[model samples]
Target: MEEKFLKVTQEGHFFDKHKSVLIAVSGGKDSMNLLHLLYKYQDILDIRIGVAHVNHQQRRESAEEEVYIKEWSERRSIPFHVSYFEGTFSEEAARTMRYDFFAEVMKQHDYTALVTAHHADDQAETIFMRLIRGSRLAHLSGMRVVQPFASGELIRPLLPFPKSELMNVPHFEDESNYSSLYFRNRIRNDYLPLLVNENPQFTSALLHVGKESELLHQALRDLICHIDVTNLQDFQAQTVAVRYFLLQHYLEEFPELQLTRDQFDQVLNILEKRANYQHHLKGDYYLIKDYQRFAITKIQPKTDRQEEEYVIESEGVFQHGSFIFSLNEPLEQPDQIIYLQVHQPILLRGRKAGDRILLHSIHKKIRRYFIDQKIPQKLRDTAIVIEQEGKIYGIANMVASDLSKSAKNDIIKATLYIKMKE
Candidate 1:
């Protein structure tokens, strides 16, 4: 068992020579065994070791467990760090808090790797549970032997070894493991034992499933390695399976976001819808789909608001929202080039209630005009118009009023330039 632990760490390249590592120990048999093994071979491995523990305060033995681990570390002259949870937390929240504290410790001490004692049984339990709950193909592979965490690596050297092999060392056991209150506890205590009894090789089979799923993920990753997900045209060109996998891969890049199968389908639905849309996800992040493009952005869509007016006194160049106005420049579209005869200090501004434009000696409300043109709500909010003496000249770059197009001398040729948001 000792030789296998060393071999796993060495073959996996879990540590560099003389690297510092922080081991996450819960004083449970599995973690204590891991700590003992690493301590025995620290000289041969050429590494420094530190111990980190978190007291969830869920069990009555929590305080005793914390002290036990601290004393064990002190006896070996190894550094020990600890944290305490203030109140109750769900299983997921507890797990998050535990890792967060581990990351904090690593940052302060410059530890290169965070070691955990998640053995083969734990891996099997995780994969089986995810399979039962229905998860993405990439997520079915269970915990990785080594993965990036915080600013360093999170290493699980005991992943390929079973729990039975790790119980040789004497250590504390949390009584909560036998309780059925937690979903994982129920799975481990009730369902898993029956499955193992029915087929003694069930755990091994689950382990094999994880390995196969990982291979499939690797193959899918290779297929789309060159594809750009943000490019709508490029993304839509792929088959559905390829697209789904790409999105899952994209979501994985963000540590703050947790990807569920439902969220996956929500994103797909928005992408498939014909019209441009902005679907709000958690916080201020949104999945934005514009004509010819789509992106993951934090910038909120331009909503209707009372916008400030900018007077175009003698515009060489003027910026308003996402638009740039270049005054006195020859425009590509003849109608959009407003040939102003009566210059009464033209102003550029967003839409207002009861705003109207003159068209062939008839008044047309700007709101009704936008509706007739089939402008999207976001575009309408940022849409600008040229106004002078309370008379609308034109909707920038879209249409020019007949009055603005009238033949005249001393005309100022003004055009609008749309600037793409960064």
Candidate 2:
């Protein structure tokens, strides 16, 4: 299936030598075959390969499975990392821990990409799962071959491969998959077989549907990503359909905000009416309309106690009430973070008058900057601003000064997050 693997890689833009990949292995047939194939072609593909395995320790054989994968990695001289969970795990908990481990492995090992062995059957199962959940096509299309990740791009090179193709590989069997105890297991083992028996090509049919879903996503992405935002007046005057796609594209870059259906429609309404409105979405998000523009911001709750500013003297994360001021992860994108050369006493305080930034070679007053960014007027006065020696280093979502623009290698960065009141 080397040709099949090549077809998927070329089709998905999955791998490259510049970015190292951390393959998630479970010693199961699918992941085993994936690791084997990647290892076989590592030199030819000009990519470095490593392994990340998580032992949730939920089962009796979990440790044995970890040892098996560890020995497999060592025998091939491949880099490997394993994380053992310490707490009880629900299915979602296990999944969360697994991805969390994947991210940590990537960061600690300097690997820039994550590879998962979710094959065609898994894709079909996901589609079936989402269909029953009454999911929208955006959520129901199952998994994409490529997705932007904080660590790097997550790629599924086996989206086109089937379990039957990988079964020949030597692997461990976790019989939990066949057990009807889990909901997915019931779908896979009980319901799907009935459909597959009726139509042998059912999985292939679902694969085609997934491919089309991706095409639609790509088309919308192309239309939205390069949209003429420079002509603000003309752009803002566009139809609601245009603004919907704009928000879709915006959400891809900022994953923290979970925009719900009501919130999204409200966003479009705000764009159409050009008025003041505030609607709370999940994740502490308040979709606010600022005249002609729309913004997603967080509200600091009011209590009998007064809000206090924080003195951040070192590279660390600290929280004061609903506000969290964190020394952010190392600079990822240039525009995403600010740099500091020294560890000075930085005060995390509310926005102040005359607080201006020289952003992108233009001097903008903080009030004007907030207006330009469409920050809600209420949030503008109380927005978090990081300052040192009377120089505004960073605002909530901006690297304020041109001088403080972080270089690619800069590690000192900071961010502010406001937790929504319960």
Candidate 3:
């Protein structure tokens, strides 16, 4: 078992022998074995070790596991950090929250890498799951041995070891793992056993296939990078041309690298359509077209949705979705009867065709006058115009009339303030 651990860690280049490591302990057999093995080898490796556990409030037994881990850490005099979350076990969400906690802990401490007990069986199960889900080669490649985590990095030193090898170390069993309701357990206890019975070397074959596929996948991705997708003036229109170029190049250089007809069609659809154009590729892979530079992004996903529109009204202070429109009562002036008064309610709606506006100064059709003024069609609707009983009193961004019916001693002026949403 020790020899196997050394071989895996050395081959995977998971961590430096003397680096400070934090092991994620779930009190399960896998994580327990991981902690024990690291401890057993710590002296020779000259490394510092810590244990981190997440108490997901799923079952009552989960609390017991946390207690066991905490006691074990104390016994070894190893620093321990436990995080608790109140939620059902949604695999994705739980994983995210757990990693976030792990990152925070790492930031507070000085850990070089966060190690976990994801072994060969876990990788095999993942590969099969992704395969059944019709995943691309990248997903089928399964979890990487070394990858970046929250603040530090994540290292899976046991990936090359089979579950049977870890049985030598003391461990605890979670009853939930036996339930076929969990997809991974079903693959481990049921499907994999049947495959092994049929062909004793099936697991080895799968591992081999995973490795070969990873290499081929990397090569294909490299070829994809060689094609210059930048400067495609119209992404939608040029999608077919870009795809055809890729197909031609692939056929000439790597005929074995053909995607399924459906997959090819889907790729083209993703490239051409605006809706899902921003969708990410597998495992730090992305397709990006930023003006003149088209590239693949390796970072985690970030969302930027379009901002929705808000409406504004007069007389009353209006709070739109993200914008605040405050309309103040006109300043009082004895002679200025044309100024906006607080008495009337203002209507706010989008513009429609043939909507006429009476310019107080000229009494002309506002739309034609706006067109003559060279106002763009897009901005015309947004340009606010105030009216009283179908008579245009003032046009915002254009003109404000001195609507005092009598020679004024004091005049009233309506003030409108637009504030953006927070």
Candidate 4:
């Protein structure tokens, strides 16, 4: 088993010499095996190891497992980090919380890699679950052996080995693994055993399926790697399959936005149909189509003061909503600029109901102008307008009405810069 471990690590290029890796130990059989093996081989691998554990606090043995793992790490003189969940969470939520804690530990402690003990059995189960749940091909392939995660790489050195091959080690077994409260537990305890009894090599067959699916998935990913999804013309030029994969790859960056097949198809359809379409996704996020480009943006929540006017009597620099106004000096990459001959105090504010701006001797409603210009509603809501003496002067970054750009020499020169969204 030790020789096989060395071979797997070597072939996978799991770690570089002299790099520090953080081990995710849960006091389970798999994680314990991984912790001990890495400790035993650290000298040969030329890597340092630290331990991290997250107590989900679901099972009765949770506290005992946390203590056991911490003591084990202390005995080996390895750095240890532990976090306890505040309350009971669903399985999905718990998994997310667990990884979030792991990521925090990695970032704070400067660990170069996060090593886990996911073996072939875990991979097989994951593939089976995803398949039954109707997932995309990429998701159905199960977990990757190594992927960029947190501050470094998330590596699973035991992926090639079956669970039966792991040597027996003293470890705590959480009873939750046998409970039906979790979908994975039900799959592992009930359905999987039945299938294995019927066909002894069923798990191996699923592993084979996972490997083939992953190979195809990687091929699709590589095919769309050169296509930029944000560039409308370039993205439209790709084949349909490539385009789908490109969108999938783009959404993968935002793990919080989960879309079903119908919703994903709707996005693709919106791209093909027209511009200026805003589709609300989960939370405050929206998929917006500008004239020629599209992007996912989170609309800022509205506040009571979002529409409040700022009285700028004489400004050196003033911030109103998302725009920064600089008086008499040029700013790098100003979104909009206009010269104003100030005879009265000017007001900087967002658009209000019944707002109209004078452009080329014609009055146009601010709302109509925005719609005609194909500006997204989210941007229009926060669009800053310059006003003086009960008349609208300009909508910053979109238009500077003829009234705002006066020819007078006694000028209050102003430049508008929009702040980058957080």
Candidate 5:
């Protein structure tokens, strides 16, 4: 059994051979078997092993499962961490809390990577789920062996092994897994059997397809990275062209991956308009256009913000009003006279009723001059104004001046970045 598991790990390139691994254990058959296999090969593989369990508090027996795992780890002298989440245990909520706890544990222990017991059957079920939900090529690619998690990496070592093999291993079954109401169990029991009856090699074929799709997906990602347009002016326009070119290229090579005529046109329109657009493709893949770039994100139901932001100092990268202010050195240019200086106690506040700037070039009141320039009245209050010593020196999104004539050659520079509010 150990030799067979070792072969499976080799096939999947599970742990990079020598990295420390944390296995998410639920005292379920798959997780228990995974822990056993890892422990069996720990010395040979030069791997440090740890177990993490999340007591979701969903089922009454969940507490028993946690106790079993805790005792099991203690008897074996393996490090173990457990987290309990109270209240609701919706699948999404449970997953989110579980990963959050796992990440914290991983960070505390400085673990290099996390291993999961997601096997070939899991991959097949994922693919089917995405396909039924209208996923794209990227979505159909299924679970990746190595993927980025919070602070570390998630490695699926058992992907190349079948669930049949996992069942054959000495393990305990979770009664919860028998419910067909859960999408995954439904696919496993009802759908997978039909596919297997039709073609005994269906699971293997899906796994093979998943591997190939993963390679293709990686190549596409590499191409996008290689064509980095970070500094290109009108980057959004360029991104639109890049996306269109990619779609065309894929269509010519693999027509099966092509979006429908209307869908393709919609993508083109989204690129051309440079707007946020969500495209539901044939498979469970979604093309999301956010500002300048396009991404193929998974099609999960909309989730609330999982991360929260706290108030920060006004000097550094801080969120103010509805904008992210990243204070940096102002661009020095001979023609541009509106730049703030360092150590200058400039107040960042909203507009005042009697705000006025000395237009050095014109020698006139800035308010009157702006009125003459036909500046809109609606923008008066919301505009940011920088004031010092009860006088407006810099108008937000407008202009600034050198207060002291003696400091003409001082070359003081400060920048204000106004971000759009969502």
Candidate 6:
């Protein structure tokens, strides 16, 4: 395996030895093997390797994993990039965050490629799962050895071996992997076991299918690589594999967005003939087909505030990505409440360019307001703002410009209420 690794590493011809790499570690034996192997052959490979970890914070031991990985990197004098995410999220969401962090780290730190620990067993399981799900042959080819991701190459060199052969490196197992909640879990626990019981070489057989499918898939990619725009009328006449490959390439740009086999078929069918077709995708995006061409597009994010002095659209509850906003009359009990007056109309949304507000009759810029409040930059990008007329009613609980009390005669105070949904 080591010789094979070295042979491929040289034949691939990517290393000047000066170029650096980023390894995605999950505190598992497979990832640990990747780290250890890279270190073992670092001198010969002539490349630098850095480590990165995404703490999904899904399990009780997730923090421990982060610490373990971080300390291991530090001990080896390797650069480390780490991030934390809150709440239990879907595997798709977790994968998105992981890649997002990896990309950010690569761009910020100048890494050449991101390496992962996907191996032959993983590919086999993935192929079988896709098979049971009725996936097309091309789609069942399993993970690629190398692909462009986040402006850098995402390479997996361990696909030649399974976890049993990766190493005996010390690592922790994620208990959730043993759970029955996930389909992949069932595949691993039930399907793979049953197949292997019938024939111990079942995984090897699956891998063989993957290799053949991948060869055919690559051929389609090479053939279609020259075709710029797929004509709607002729798309259906093409081989099913060709159409599937086109959609697969289209989806590569957005790894977070995924389509099942049925969904993939539906997209192709809709694009081939259906006019005025639109499919809403996850994460505020959608696929729209115009005439002969189809493209993935983002939904224009809705905001309550359209322009200066926009009146409140309604006095009812308004929900944005993660925050909830509402308007109410001054209540008897108030906590974390900002006072506002019944001005023109009110609107709530994130801050925009050139957004200025008046607080205690003092003019303040929204950008400066977020900085002064010590709100993190990412959160500030989506900070909820309450605005009326040209003045800011509230800057996300920081400043609530009093607009209701125009004169001393007015006693009742209107209120703007905001809370982040958990």
Residues 1-422, candidate 5, lDDT per residue (tens digit)?
Answer: 56887876776666764367889998877788789889889877778999999887777888888888888889989899999997766777888888889899989998878888888889998988887877666667898778877677898887767777774554556777889878888888898899899999988887777778778867766776544232122334455546665555434333345576588777566656645577767777666655534444344442232123232224554454444445552333322233445566556566432244556543344556568877785554345565554445565455665453323445764554544444
Cα deviation at 417, candidate 4, in Å, is 18
lDDT minimum window of 10 residues, candidate 1:
413-422
Cα lDDT of model 2 by residue, 149-259, tens digit: 656878888877787777478888898888788989998988889999999988788777777877888788776655533123545766767766666665554467766
The CA lDDT of each predicted structure is 0.78, 0.71, 0.64, 0.80, 0.66, 0.73
In candidate 1, which residue pairs get closer than 3 Å at backbone N, Cα or C atoms, i.e. clash? none
TM-score for each candidate, following the candidate numbering: 0.70, 0.67, 0.57, 0.69, 0.58, 0.60
Candidate 2: list runs displaced more than 4 Å: 6-13, 17-19, 225-236, 239-246, 299-422
- Candidate 4: misplaced stretches above 4 Å? 58-60, 300-422
In model 4, the number of clashes is 0
Each candidate: how many clashes? 0, 0, 10, 0, 6, 6
Best by TM-score: 1
Native-referenced Cα lDDT, model 3: 0.64
> Model 1: per-residue lDDT, tens digit, 239-350?
8877877888777766677656687689987776667787778777777776445666565344556368888777465667665666665434333466554345778888
Q: 95, model 6: CA deviation in Å?
A: 1.9
Q: What stretches of model 1 exceed 4 Å from their correct place?
A: 259-263, 300-422
Once superposed on the true structure, which residue ranges of model 6 sit more than 4 Å away at CA? 14-18, 224-422
> Which stretches of candidate 3 lie above 4 Å from their native place?
221-422
- Candidate 6 lDDT tens digits, 136-233: 67667899887777767888888877877766888989999999888889999988999899999999999999899889877877887655433454
Which candidate should be chosen as best, given lDDT against the real structure?
Answer: 4
Which of the two, 1 or 5, has more TM-score?
A: 1
